[model samples]
Target: MSAAETTTAKVPPTRPSTAQGAGGGTGGAGKPAVRRRAGGGAALPWTLLAPCLLVLLLVLGYPLARLVALSFQKFGQPQLWGFQEPESVGFANFTKILGDGEFWAVVVRTIVFAGGAVILTMVLGMLTALLLQRVSGWVKTLINIALVASWGMPIIVATAIFKWLFDTDYGVLNWLLSRLPGVDMVGHNWFASGPQGLAVIMLLVVWGAVPFVVITLSAGLTQVPKELEEAARLDGAGSWGVFRYVTLPVLKPIIVMLTTLSVIWDMGVFPQVFVMRNGHPEAEFQLLTTYSYDKAFVVNDYGGGSAIALVTVVLLLGVVAVYMRQMLKIGEVE
Candidate 1:
């Protein structure tokens, strides 16, 4: 070989490119580094979130864990405060509650109460929404203010007010009913009777529930195309026909979502029922919430209470699952 050719072979023919430096960088070199940095960056949020998660665990998880644990053992305040040890009887609490006719009766009552409350809430809400659409802007503002006030009323205060309003002897409702034609309920002991007592509780639930449903469905109603309703009317569709055909179809998903929320809320209503139970602690009006509460607090049966609460939770989960399945089938939620 010639000297020049030998020198050229000994030295490299091409220099290494800057892109492929000591790092042996491929085209995706930046991407991998970026990915690593992005991953590290992503962990920052979770790191910041760690404290919140810990607090959540302390607040919710601990209580839930305790409740589940208690359900397997016979406990009261003594066991709760570690004053005495509890007797562990696995599944006994569950069997006891499940086998009880009273518990089953309460379950049925709770279901009925939830259904009635949900229906009344949706109906009144829908009607209120429709009414809002017909009113002027000033009327809307006033109506919305009233709704906000109603919604913002504390449960305790609302329960108190309801108790006052239906206080058999001095109640405004009884007074009003007394004045009405063919009615004689002036001094009627409203809560003395089971049917009347249940009605009062239902009224309270429905009253507190309606405002939220009204506001949410009002928003949904606004999203509905006005043109569709107008077209339906042009085709000789009355108000009912327009609502049933055009408006309802468009608002079905929203309605279902709200109904699901209402079911969840009304099913777990505690304060109102608790207060009402003070007046009449019958199987007729005793919902799961008040029933569980009475077991836990009133009777001091922690295991039984826990079992009842757990059963109520399971029922709620079942209902939510059914609702979500329907919503998912229709692609309402991702």
Candidate 2:
């Protein structure tokens, strides 16, 4: 072969561009360093959050742990500078409380009171919301201001007000009743009896709690499409029918939420019962919360009080679980 042709054959073909090389490198180049900066960046937040987590552990977690531990121990007498070592009694305290007839009675009363208060509050709240919706100008503003003011007042203050209102001798309620025809026993001590005291407490609870329900339901009412109600009315549905078929279905979720909240709040109510009756006359009007307080503070029975607190926690958790399950079912339906 000619020299030129021989030289051409000896030369190798031109290689592909550097970008086209396998793994983005020529044979001599090392693999590109794998960057892991994103992972380090992500971990920076958790590092920053470590202090918050420590603070939470110190503030909230430690106290809850202590409470759970103390619930198992008997209330020991105070020492020279601090509380003595609690008597370790396992589940004895719990068993004693569970078997007590009085405890069971108080539980029943609490349930009844909570149920009654929730029902009354929801009904009154719905009515109030509807009324406020229909009204306008000064009246609406006035009513809203009053409801908000009542709701904003401290529970202790509200309870004191209720106590004075139901007072036998100097109460405005009894004084007003004295002027009514055929009402002779106007000076009757309302809190002296269980039923009357419970009634007063229930009324106060309803008054305070109704505002929350009203606000929630009123918001829900605003979200309900008015066209649906108008269409229902056009189809010969009366007020009741329109509400039943259109408004209620739309408002059901909010109603359920309000009812559950009301139940939870009323179940734990202590101020009203404590300030009004002091669980007085007997334990007839005693609720679980007040009973627990009396056991812990009044009678100085910490073990029994802890047991009651634990039971209340369990019942409230059960209620929350049931509500969540029902909400899940509702979500599934939707």
Best by lDDT: 1
Q: Which TM-score value belongs to model 1?
A: 0.82
In model 1, what is the error at residue 88, expressed in angstroms? Answer: 2.1
* lDDT for each residue of candidate 2 in 103-199, tens digit (9 for 90 to 100): 9999998999899998899889999898888987699889878888999999889988887887878888888888899886577888677777798
Give the 10-residue window scoring lowest on summed lDDT in candidate 1.
Answer: 22-31
Q: Model 1: residues >4 Å from true position, as ranges? A: 1-54, 81-83, 234-236, 277-283, 332-334
Q: CA shift at 59, candidate 2, in angstroms?
A: 5.2
Per-prediction TM-score: 0.82, 0.80
Candidate 2 worst ten-residue window by lDDT: 27-36
Strongest candidate by TM-score: 1
Backbone clashes under 3 angstroms, per model: 0, 0
For 207-249, candidate 1 gives per-residue lDDT tens digits of: 8888888998888888888899899999999989999998898
List per-prediction Cα lDDT, in the order shown.
Answer: 0.86, 0.83
